[model samples]
Target: MSELSVTTRSGPNGPVVEVAGELDHDTASEVRALLSGLELRPGTQLVVDLTALTFCDSSGITVLLAARNHVLAAQAGMALSGVPDRVQRVFRILGLDQVFVTYPTVEDAVAAWPQQTE
Candidate 1:
């Protein structure tokens, strides 16, 4: 079993959460709790960095979806960065690739955020 770790940081777009772990059923609730505890201001663009994630199970996928819903409920934006190729393949296989917006890096995700309207 791989250990789970999540680090949160403030960024120009919003709060960026860097996740490193094997996200399986055993660890998904912890991740979900971390996400649930966040208070995103309106329009904040949340980015989840998954570059160090080694594995993700269905429960992990559910947690990710929950994160997305949380952002939406707060009227904020959310995206995933640094998704591993295997994870991407799994998402595609599950037809979840279309449900998520992912980028190659944090910078890319930040750059793609919708500019604040004047």
Candidate 2:
């Protein structure tokens, strides 16, 4: 199994989380914890880049939901980019496609984010 790794970077839209490796039961908690720690400001857009993700399971999906909840609680928006076909199919099958905004690339998501007016 590929080990999960997460990296973060700040963008004009908000925080960009780059996830690599397998996102399964064993590593879901780590993802949750990392997301929970983010200081999401109201209207901030959180983009999760999954371009490097190799695998995902139910637990991983749960963690993604948790991240969305976190963003919602902060009055922020969340989007997923670079989702693999395997994972995207699961989201479609579970009807989660309507729950999160998806983009073909992280740049697309960021560009689509509502700008925070000064």
Candidate 3:
């Protein structure tokens, strides 16, 4: 099985979590834990970068949904960036394409974030 790596960095809008390698049952918890621990605030946006993700199973999908819920509960927005075509197909098939807001690049995701009003 391919190893997974999940890293986070501060972005202009909020936090950007970059996930690389396989995201299957074995590694889904790692991603979930990190997401659960994120300090998202209202009006902020969270972007999950899946550009380097090579594989994902049902467990991975569940974790992504959990992340979404976590962000929403914090009153923050969320988006997925650099989704692989294969995964997109799966999302489409499951009707999850409608559930997630996706972008071709991380920059696009950040740019799409709602501007905060002073």
Candidate 4:
């Protein structure tokens, strides 16, 4: 299995975690564990920058949902940024694209994030 990696970058709003490599059952657990410690305050946007994600399975999708729930519970916004077409197809098929705010890029998401707060 290819190793999964995560990198984080922060802005005035909040942290955007960049996920790379294969995200399957085994590696998904690491993501979940990391997300468990996230502090998504009210109005902060937690953007999952999925630009480099090579692969993602059902377990990965579940972790994404969990992340969404965590941010929503804290009244913060959650967004998927730079999602590959493959992943977008999955979200579209599942009708999750309608529920989750998706952007072409992190900048686009961040630009819209402040609007959601207001």
C-alpha local distance difference test of each model: 0.89, 0.90, 0.92, 0.86
Q: Pick the candidate with the highest TM-score.
A: 3
lDDT score, candidate 3: 0.92
Candidate 2 wrongly placed segments (more than 4 Å)? 115-118
Model 2 TM-score on a 0 to 1 scale: 0.94
lDDT of 2 by residue, 39-109 (tens): 99998999999999999999999999999989999999999999999999999999998887889999999
TM-score of each: 0.93, 0.94, 0.95, 0.93
After superposing candidate 4 on the true structure, give the runs of residues whose Cα lies further than 4 Å from its correct spot.
none
Candidate 4 clash pair list:
none
Task: Compare candidates 2 and 3 on TM-score and give the better one.
Answer: 3
lDDT of 1 at 40: 91
For candidate 3, lDDT tens digit of each residue in 1-118? 5599999999998999999999999998989999989999998999999999999999999999999999989999999999999999999999999999999999998887785221
Ranking by lDDT: 3, 2, 1, 4
How well does model 1 score by local distance difference test?
0.89
On a 0 to 1 TM-score scale, where does candidate 3 land against the true structure? 0.95
What lDDT score is found at residue 22 in candidate 4?
Answer: 83
Q: Quick one: how many clashes does candidate 2 have?
A: 0
Between 1 and 4, whose lDDT is larger?
A: 1
Model 4 per-residue lDDT tens digits across residues 52-106 = 9999999999999998888889988888898989999999999988878888888
Alpha-carbon deviation at 18 in model 1, angstroms: 0.6
lDDT of candidate 1 at residue 6, scale 0 to 100: 91
Per-candidate clashes come to: 0, 0, 0, 0
